[model samples]
Target chain A: MLDPQIIIAGVLNGLLAGGIYVLVAVGLTLIYGVLHIINFAHGSLLMLAMYAVFFLWRLAGLDPYVSLPLVTAGAFAVGFVLYRLVIGRFSHGKDENILLITLGVSIVADNLALLFFGGDTQTIDVPYAGDIIQVGAAFLPLPKVISCGAALLICLVLGLFMTRTDTGKAIRAVARERQGARLVGIDVEHVFAVSYGIGIACLGAAACLLMPTFYVTPQSGYAFVLVAFTIVVLGGMGSFLGAAVGGFLIGITESLGGLFLGEQLGQIGISLIFILILLLKPTGLFGSRA
Target chain B: MRHLALAAALLAAVVYPLLVPNYLATVGMLMFFTAFIGQSWNISGGFAGQTSFGHAAFFGVGAYTSTILQVTYGWNPWLAWPAAMAMGGLVGAGIAVLSFRAGLRGSYFALITLAFAEVFRIAANSASITRGGLGMLIKADQRPINFQFKDQIWIYYLAFALCLVSLLIAWWLTRSRFGARLVAIRENEDAARALGIDVFTEKVKVLALSGAMCAAGGTFYAQKYLYIDPNIAFGIDKSVEMLLVTMVGGAGTIFGPLIGSIALTTINELTRAAASVFPALKNVQPLSLIVYGAMLVLIVARLPDGFASLLGRRRHA
Candidate 1:
């Protein structure tokens, strides 16, 4: 039952899956760091973005990779506007209210997709979808390898944007000290919207990458969102490095857990980790003291 | 004057089922049943301000406990009901101690509860004692002694009575010292502790009470539907439903859950009926949910007191 080759293959597959998970967690951690509220709509928004990718492929002849930039930008705009219009205006300065409001947003967004798109599992068939790449004992799908690489590239770019740019510095300042940022003449609200946009933009890219290998339903958002949240929590809320590393860890857990526990009970590993981390250390691995 | 109004309302409620058709009675039953469960949520979430996202955990425990007791052990379901509540209370207190001892608050608490519920869901799905996704079905013993009624009107009355009981609990919470302590904790836990209140014990107590009520609701639900499954027993849907009714109704107020339940059930039935009628409109089930979701946002933003505030009475929730 414990084949080293099979375990190595599982590890490899988990790493491949982790790339996109990192992208998703990065978005969530960014939002939580800045806003101090869990965005419940994160999953629903991802689902909607996946639908966009699906429609782009179905309506036009655009491949998932080709449409990446478009969807990412569009997602950014959506996030920015959503913050300005709904989340910022209505939260009443309470984190709990924002959580509930986001919960509502997710409900609305999910049902809207159900109403408009119908409940169907959609996937894109890129011509090279079946292509494979071999490494060590593992045989990986070509698309998965490409997505993994692309996802990492996007994360590196995002990290650079966060650390190297003046806007990035200002966003960080706002995250660290909102009042202090305002005192220093930074536009706090603008920084907020920008951060939120950048966060959601990650999801857009994730959606594009995910379309090749994974199927999207109204539920894909929820499925990925929970895993992303686990990654974020495990990594430490708001820690980019944590998100990156935690993503791979969770991906491996899912793969290995399924190997040992069977499909039905395998999912428990993630939930258990989430519960334990929160109970033992709410700050997570990289988060500051709670 | 208030007492007279209350008497008149109770009078109307007593006569309502008799006057209405059996279909309408069932709808009323659903409204009251939801109100009962929603009120249980209101106790901890609304009144005590300890919002949970996994009340379904307790709900499932009650459901499975009663079903197993009746089906496997041959224990009467009526006897199993209180036993289920005991189990729910124990689970509730256990969760409270684990979380509160670690000082989990706000979203942390909410998310932990969700995780716990998920754990239960997975356990139910995998454990053979639960029959592992096959679900359990109650025997069709349609006699009053078995807690299953033939006419369905008795069940309606049972639901209505349950809702009334929950309302009384809410009313007591608003007036009792225990309730006051919970409210103080909600307003400011530090202040409550400063005022010589044991915040931890109070929170645990309220959660136990809320859990017991919720568990009773679960048993009622299992008996009503005559089926219990992992998904049905511990689903996020029930958690969402409990939260939605309380939040959309009035949260802390005595009448909030009842009002919210009626509004929710009405919207649900209306949208489903509309979809059935138009056929061209095809699916309004999502439409109703959309409406509920939008209402949640709007209420959180503009009407924090919910529709209960529109009653033109100045009462503290």
Candidate 2:
């Protein structure tokens, strides 16, 4: 017989994991949707943001939560520059070339982080790091709860912003049909930059919010990125609703898998699930193409 | 002209081990092996245009199979090598059959492969047969069954020979019908499919063959090192290095990966040597990665066809 509290706790954890997935997955999908290039280095950008938060905390003594805006800005600037200098040059090009370029960016960023920060995992010892909230018979860590809250807030805000803003509408236009958007006097280049910027900012925010709950390391991005990719694929690339919904599904599946199976098995199980999803639905559950 | 080029390449490879310093000899061996991996990658990724990111799965399969056989059954490492390679190829074939059957190509195919590699890595880490994370260590130091080397020179020589054989195979593959189909699929899969070419089957066949070739490389790698660990065998860095070699030198050409390997490996060795003196540079072991990334960007931006195309042009000129 399974513990009822364990199930509840798993659901909560899943919801949190799902929220983070949505944030990372959205960025990946958006870039892929607009540019038709899968940003293999998406995780590296997330890593950069985590490090940004680390430095802010260590140097400026700013709280991780308080530094969200700063990290968001930093991520945006990085994305904008990358688009203007690197991606802008390759815009409207072959997809493989773009994929390779993004992969290169990922490699550069990962190694740079490794070089400067060393291959060590660092964490912020926040005041609430040790705090936990007891839910009936189950206990939830406070940091995870906060991370989940931040993830939800970020997604909701970004979703609203994308749907509400004219810039956002242009971005959507670009994603849905590039040639059509270009003919309508929409600055496709600027739209590309803004969408890419928003996507990077989303990942950046995720990295910062996750710092309190998880340690930051140069190699950490690979793990998260893999999961995020799985979520993106499962959620259907470029589908915002799919990303949000897929995040929770994967998170819950992961939590339940982790609790029932061992930790290692849980991770493997998710990977297997990712492969299955690809096989069953190449366009994804909510993919636009299919 | 091709024969002359091949002869020249063989000459360089044969003499390389003798002329290079010990550290360089080791790097040379790695470069050769990596070149082999890259060439094999090109069969599927470049020629077939599959772009599998999970090649480490095949590599790990080869290493683990060889290691387990050598350790448990006391099989001669040489005899077990072919068997180990076959297992990896078989797995690759299985993956191809499944993935390509669904018409999953390009990024979708690459993601699936990546996931499979991660799955294999995690499973290997937890499996008792792999000794879990402890991995497999040789019981004897220098017995023929042990596959342990008393000197690095021997391993270098063996790796060099394997490299030559792999290059020859890669050359033959490019001229073969299967290779032609792979290239056709790579250039335009939909057109190939329309013309009665079984694109899915061709992709799987090439991927399987490439997996086998990579597995052969992995078998030798494990046997030479006489140690096999999940992380080392299934590392993403290995996959990246293979891609770097192909991308840097030329993807479709026969000797592209080989040239890329030599150039990149030499630069890496140079950086490593510099690191020994500077110390700070040593901490940044991944600086080469940045260079690799930059080179990738440059290649995509300037010459999408790769450096080999430049050589081809010069030849035609």
Candidate 3:
């Protein structure tokens, strides 16, 4: 019923949106792959990071790009200390306990944002927000295009860091075989804190990318939590490539779904996909373990 | 001694409503209603060790089903209530079969339930039958047969009665054979399976039961408020609230949800009163929730048994 050109445009739009999702999912999958627990607070933390970006811009007149590194560093420190102080200390190596703790953490974080940030939906006004980039049948916004490119570059750099660095190797080791890593004298606890830090750092980068196009509300974090989990599961938990691909696929689904199914029902596809993946093949694209 | 305590508590509840103002009576109703729903969650998540993150799916389904039947089809509210429970049970069974069949449990199960609730919410948002995002309103008629009441105290009694029924069901679970099997599954699923327990069937059964109970609570809520919307019907907040109460009180204990509800409602009311007094303390609602969040974390970490444990720590622990 639709023109091929229109369809193409929708797909392009979805892919651009999916870039931010990939960055968020990367953090989620890393937490999942290493900690072996679903970080229920991922969205809330991302929300906190978005607030940081908003304040940095609102208070200091700094552009999001300029504040990315500072916000990312701050997020990483918070994540590390949070794990050491509450999560690791309380979890006692139980997956379910960790899940509950994170659920509690997310509740706290979301409400904390509500308490401080108020419930108003805030968006940044970048000068180039209205600028457009034409690709084939699609005309993408400049901010989206920039965010997409930056997201991909960040993922690539993170991949290299994971594959090349000793700490990365140590993190991988811990993820693969925790006891073996411990036997080799890897400070497993330190690695956990670092991995959590890196995961939250990804969220920091994502917050900067998202602020240009998206609005920030206390509820925004809760909205992304499900989408991030869906993408992470779709990509195969802990698989960077899977997360990236899943991000694009989900993006396309969202774009097309909105185009065809209407805005209200378009979100049903994501929830259904999450259920189906969990039911039929939870390992996802690159995962061997469910 | 425990029986005497419960008897005294029951007597106090019956008379306390008579002594309280209308506003306080309404608060009592809310506390009991919350406890009933929380008990519904405790049945699956606590007693059966099947933690669901989307009990709202069942609650919403129940609320919508009864409302649609009564408003659209002209059924009695009493009849619609049972129909709602049946619909809720069917949905619970469907989710359970799909999930448990695929060997999902723990966090995976929790996530899937959340997704199902989302699906229901989005569908409800778009569907014409549900009136879209504008929400559906029940015609207000101050008649007992129609399930509407002119007097607030009567609704309070109804909520109180529902809480009592839920408490009885929980008490039965504490002593019944079905309860023992569910506890086994919660403590260790593989071992229960090894011992010839039909883990799959039992889980589906418990989920269905929990769903029915939650749905009944939903109908009660709709009747009290006379409104149902996509978000109000199938929101994550309701799910979290149910889990919070049960966990804060004591997950597996029969009285856990009741205790948790009392504690939370008291805090909620106190904060509300404080906010009203301060005028400048605009975030009292979220402030109280922050305390709840803190309490949830502390309870999960240091006091897993919840406040219920405080009364009977040696007996249960």
Candidate 4:
């Protein structure tokens, strides 16, 4: 049997990674809930946010943590404009068209990053970049611990907002039934824009949290986006709480999978689970039948 | 008038190869190969209304299987073609069974397919037989029996034949009951099921056929390219290229894949040529992808029916 400390460390690492997945997956589920379009470009939007944070850190000498709100706000504005200008035109179009459009957006965003950043992998260097915290027998990296906490806190705040705020209720109303929402005098289009913006805003926040610990590359979002997809599907689509739980589950799976299956096969393990879950329960663990 | 048009087109196809330079012939070969792949994709995607984003899985299986067989066992590459198709079909059937049994539709199905491809790619990367990222290189031999051609013309002819075969199959499908059933499923699955259509079985069968055809294209690709790498064989970009070619031509139509492939290949060649001629553009990143993305956006926004629809309108006029 493995050492208790090793297992605990792995679990901690998985939880940290799961926190990031939760944030990204929640955003994806939110967009899916309201817009009913699987935004293939969600990862690309996160890529852009990473770049934004990188530039802020490099040029303005701001720490990634300090720049979180700024990046989130910036991403929100961009997402809102993008929806109004491009996505709004195809709100009622075929699912395939919406899928293609978002894919197009992804390709454009990825190539644009390549053109501008020249494909070099960059990372932000903060004072606590090498710091660690001790938890009994297990040691936790400070960055991971902090980011994971922040992610959970954000999810909690989002949960409260969803249940408490009128706009949040309106968004939910639209998601449940668009026609009924419109009949009740909800501005469905505005809600869509807001939902998309919030979804992207989550990506921006995730970028800031992730930058300190992870390398930022033009293609970095591709793998993370895939992981987020698995998480969203496993947790149940359109369920925020499910995404959070699913995030932790995938995180733990990846960490333990890496520990046992070797580094490369760890990814395969996640994919296998994703496929099995999809085949066994298309509705996901917490999702209702569509 | 239709017969005359067909005769003229056939004559041009037969004679143009003899007249064009080898480089242009190579481009023509690529266009046709892409069209073949696109048409195969259309069987499941357009006709059956099942969008797959992981076709590269089937494609990569074909390329890797044939290449590995030839390299390891000195097997005739021609023999490897059927093996590739069988492998592709098996994988396709597996995916179809699992996904359909679970009732995965639309994006869920697409994502699952992507996951499978990614798994395959990662497996290829780690497996020693696949050479683990160094890639497999086939020796250049101009023997006809080895499926290697001394001249590019033979390759062009082979690709043209394959394209014609795929087109004929697609055309036959349009006139068959299976094709009609596929169309019914595409338009409305629940309604078709209510009408006594075995939705699950039909989808799996169509997917298997599509996978087999795509696998054949992969074998042809490996034989021509003389190299097999995980990235080249299993890349998501390859899958996207297939989808783009089919969609731009007009999904669900016999000639759509052909037109889309020709248009996309032309655009790609033109961009490369322009990039080479301009010194300033040399150091700059290649603009082909940006153009592709822009084209996708423009097409989705303004020309969802694709360029094939424009041709259809002119024919009616």
Q: Which candidate has the top score in TM-score?
A: 3
For candidate 3, the C-alpha RMSD (Å) to the true structure equals 1.1
User: Where does the lowest 10-residue lDDT sum fall in candidate 3 chain B?
Assistant: B308-317
Q: If candidate 4 were superposed on the true structure by all CA atoms, what would the RMSD be? A: 1.9
A59-98, model 2: which lDDT tens digit per residue?
9998888998889888998998899898877644656667
User: C-alpha displacement of A25 in model 4, angstroms?
Assistant: 0.8
Ranking by DockQ: 3, 1, 2, 4
* Candidate 4 accuracy as lDDT: 0.88
**Candidate 1 residue lDDT tens string, B118-188:** 89999999998889899999999999888899999899989989999999999999899999999999889
Clashes of 3: 0
Better of 3 and 4 by DockQ: 3
Clashing pairs in 1: none
Full ranking by TM-score = 3, 1, 2, 4
Most DockQ-accurate candidate: 3
Instruction: Return the TM-scores of chain A for each candidate in numbered order.
Output: 0.98, 0.95, 0.98, 0.97
lDDT of 4 by residue, B1-317 (tens): 88899889878887777999988988889999999999988889878889888999999999999999999888899999999999999889889998998888887788888889988988988799988678899889989999999988899989999999999989988999999999999899999999999999999999999999999998999999899998889888789888888877888889988998988888778777777898555523336677777777878788876788898899898
TM-score of each: 0.97, 0.96, 0.99, 0.96
Candidate 4 clashing pairs? none
DockQ per candidate, 2 decimals: 0.82, 0.74, 0.84, 0.63
